[model samples]
Target: MASVTLTLLPGPDLLFVITQSVSQGKRDGIAVSLGLCSGLIVHTFAAAVGISALLYHSAVAFQLLKYAGAAYLLYLAWMSLKETGRSGLSATEPKRSFFSLYKRGILMNVLNPKVSIFFLAFLPQFISPAVGKIPLQMITLGGLFFVQALLIFSLVSVFSGMAGEKLLKKSMGSKSISYVKAAVYALLGVRLALLEK
Candidate 1:
């Protein structure tokens, strides 16, 4: 449907990032993905306010951030590929703080080039400039999108919890799945970085 596509404007690949990461419940992985999704909320609001204007008018600024993000993503990907999807902490729980995880989610979305661009591009479709209060509309729409994202991403969290918990119980092999999850995040980051304008 149109609505589904719009919320997921970046397409199936992005979903794949979430899906693959959620395939198991690495708490850190789920935390990171939620952090990313939460970051989208901030991007949505910032775009709704003025980031979209800057992106539309300032070519240099956009490119600078784009490349920076790309480099980071590639670094993540390279790190992932280096181990061929094998990491020692795959089954170990790191000392992660909940507040830090939430903060990380916010940053992931904020630093994410694709999300910044998508909010700049997508939410305007249903807006009516002629009706009145454009800022209000952007806010309303952005809020709606956040709610949609929250609903979906939270479900992802639950699944991540369930799946990871279930798999972890079965065998030691579950640890390798953690590496694949990181690889997915890195790849998703790289792909997002490569997008044009």
Candidate 2:
């Protein structure tokens, strides 16, 4: 229940997926979600091996990662803003490759140091010393969290994608959509940049 609630919260990952769905389509949204979840595998392993603890304790490392994430988000915002002049999804508009979006999602998730720290703090609460092989227990719990997150993200993608298609059919201008995307990315970047360890 906690995992479900957390997944449903309006965090960066959720907002990113929604923006992709609204602007691009459902397929792209799902690709991004998959990449984001795949990045979680790294966090899961880090938490199991106690590497996340190092990130939590090292302020420099945390700051470096946080800044990198913020910079990347700002870059994305700039790119979206640049596209604002293009006409609405005309036949000439080149579709973004799924792999690119997927890679973007992976980088976005992996660069956020807070996620590893979150896993470090959240996973151990459910662990028991009597269970033995603590790493295995953490991995199991991480898998459950990953599955639930993927399901929720995918559902959001589908619904948002449908709405986006309808909006496009209603003759919404591409510039307007680009402006919205740019604003979202910019806001998220600023929020990340201001994050503290």
Candidate maximizing TM-score: 2
Q: Runs in model 1 with CA error above 4 Å?
A: 1-5, 8-34, 74-92
Residue-by-residue lDDT tens digits, candidate 2, 76-161: 99998887777435577788788988899899999989899899989999999898889999999999999999999999999988
Global CA lDDT computed for model 2: 0.88
> Runs in model 2 with CA error above 4 Å?
87-89
Q: List the residue pairs that clash in candidate 1.
A: 25-164, 35-105
Q: Which candidate number would show the highest lDDT if scored against the true structure?
A: 2
lDDT of 1 by residue, 135-163 (tens): 67877877776666656666666665666
How far does residue 181 in candidate 2 sit from its true spot (Å)? Answer: 1.0
User: Candidate 1 versus the native: TM-score?
Assistant: 0.74
lDDT of model 1, residue 135: 69
Show how many residue pairs clash in every candidate, following the order shown.
2, 0
Q: How many collisions between residues are there in candidate 2?
A: 0
Worst 10 residues of 1 by lDDT: 84-93
